[model samples]
Target: MAFKFGSFDSICGQGALPVCPLLGTSQGIEPGCYSRNVDLGGTIIFQPGACFIHIIALIMTLIMVLHIRSKYTAVGRKEIALFFYVYAVIELLCLFLDSGIIPTAHVVYPWFTAVHVGFICSIFWILLANGFVGFQFAEDGTPMSLWSLRISAFVVWGVSFFVAIATFNGYASFSYTKPMGLFIVLLVFPIVCVAIYVVSQLILVIRTLDDRWVIGDILFGVGFFTVGAVVLFAFSVTVCDAVEHYIDGLFFFVLCMLLSVMMVYKYWDSITKEDLEFAVGDKGAVWEVKECVVPSSFPPSRLASLPPRLRVFEVVALYLLTRSVSLPPSLSVPCSHLRTPTSRRRTTSLRTEEPEDLSSEEWEETSTTAPNLLEETTEATLPRDRVKATEARAASKGSTTRTHRREVFGTKKERESLLGRIGFSFFDASLPLSFFL
Candidate 1:
């Protein structure tokens, strides 16, 4: 219906009561030729296309919010997530209100419409604040930033709600025929907020970044928003008639809006780089074992200082690296202390030697030596005489056995430090090393 511009007096057709766009009232716009409503039982559903699109938009907003939450280290993540949350709520209210599920005649229609309108204003306000957040004006996700954003948004919502309710009820200076306050708040305010947000973000991207690609995201978002607005406001009736009422501008509008929101997330994610290397909490663990586990030089006090579970982790780590889990007869020493070239060579020699070759005295000496392997193997340096004896004994075995031992032990480069070996093994293992680390 035609509304008199700033005129309170009744005058011809222009004085007709103005219909709120979301209230499902006739705006004197003619229905398309194919316009029809779905009737199930006694209930009638209106604008099914718009309703379905609203649901899709709501789901997409929720998904975008979840994606924002995943960026644990991204700047302004919390603020962006909050913006999507508000958008999701607005889309939910729009779905019910626009679909006739909550009929226009319902008693709570005006209140729901007020809330929906208020949220629309608040969401744009939040978006503008987010644009400022990119500049680090107040530290995006801090208590001060969040609290100020929330409080200001709430104030905007309260004021918008008051204006909407006042217009609907014709309270104060508001009138259905002349809703200046409602028009300014519902239409003009959102437009201003969006324009300011666009300009602020453009400045942020251009001034702070060397990558110019993000500019395309902002442009695409603006393009979609502009096309959607033109389609919904300027050509809704024409498009409805052209499409035979099967679908109208609202469907395309919601679709474009969803794309715009997705672009917003894309732009934010592109510019905000998360330091994945140092990221902690839900993103991933940042803990790293910088010190290598050198058994020969490892101090007893240091080993004792470690937590019990950490010691077990070191043992498991060594086992994974060597692909061997053999425990010495005495379990008093740490597992790393057992991994010595001398003990491995001695074991190889024992495996190749005949039991009959050792006399009674040699066997007794060997038995006494086996018990002290843990202590002797963990020494900083082996005695020269013991090394010569072991070498002589290894030589007594056939050359074939010595070659096999060399193959088994690998080159000195292959037998790297425990930490280096474990690093390669961790990646190749079936289970992720993150669980242990």
Candidate 2:
């Protein structure tokens, strides 16, 4: 029996490569060996899926990066996420250089050298993303320094530079022997570092779980943690064969895109401590959002300021508690339908661009129903009509009492119209006929 990837292997047949499986099927071995000439080139293209996945991830990355920079102030964790994309682009480019995947992808000796360099950069990025989550976790109450983030990033770049140089010099031949040293540097180091960083960040967030932002940060950390786990599993396992290379990368890129979207949504508003309130009781806890206050002026640091001092239960509850908005016991409109009838259905009062998808009777019924619904809402909200003007009309014409009263009680408190007797507030000329003038 063979390890089948759907009906793909059966259809595609054998592929040309040294990178393909040792024994394609189980029958090859007298006891356990299995060999079948399966077409892996058909299974995995020369460019592989990572380069394409990179394109998708790159687009997502750019949209978020542009949105963050243009709409909001500062970079923070979102900027860190941007590095994930940069790494993707670099990794894909390196693969193209080695495999001649891209159009006119000329494979030079230097390019083969660059494959090792690109691998180092990729590792650095994963570690960087992991470390950023840690930095975000540390941002409770204190203003996280932009300078620190910059410095750390630059340091990673510097280190990546040196590592690339070393790899270029040491591993001259592309097909170097099975290197235990490369394994330690590539697989073990990044995995251990990422694990430590993520776990530490989790611990930090838990310690100061008061801030809802912290909860968001925790989610971000978890996402990266999963990415790191997948990467580590793929790299560390000898039998896995680099997670089938292209397939693993495709999965990884897509996962990052998903995580990036969520992170963008979570941190969109750039919320402060004032924006949230915690309501804890026997029914568990819920985030009581007042007016969600986004900072008009961000601090010098792109980093979000984490809120201080929360119960441990809040942290645990954050994990248990869902991220969805709390719905009313009875929703006015179901989730399936978001747009109100007012937005979708046209009223006779307002002529819409699109024709109504209804018959004459249906249109009439709909138009009528809309007004009645509005009237019901208005009637509930509006105060009872007091006919003061009507009362005055009948009271007196001979006596100036009604007139005097009209002059005295000039305005109604809750009147919709702005027809109240507004006395002249600022008169440029102090004359008797100044108001009239």
Best by lDDT: 1
Off by over 4 Å in 2: 1-48, 74-85, 91-99, 102-152, 168-175, 178-181, 209-437
Write one digit per residue (lDDT tens) for candidate 1, span 42-109: 88777777777887887777777877787788899899888898988988887787667886666687
Tell me the RMSD of model 1 versus the true structure: 12.4
Each candidate's number of clashing pairs is 1, 10
Q: What TM-score does model 2 achieve against the real structure?
A: 0.39
lDDT of 2 by residue, 1-65 (tens): 33233221221122211111112232111111112222365543443443455466556656765
| Residue 98 C-alpha lDDT in model 2 | 21
lDDT for each candidate structure: 0.62, 0.36
For model 1, the stretches where C-alpha displacement exceeds 4 angstroms are 1-35, 281-437
With a 3 Å backbone cut-off (N, CA, C), the pairs that clash in candidate 2 are: 13-38, 13-39, 14-38, 14-39, 15-38, 15-39, 15-40, 25-34, 28-34, 29-33
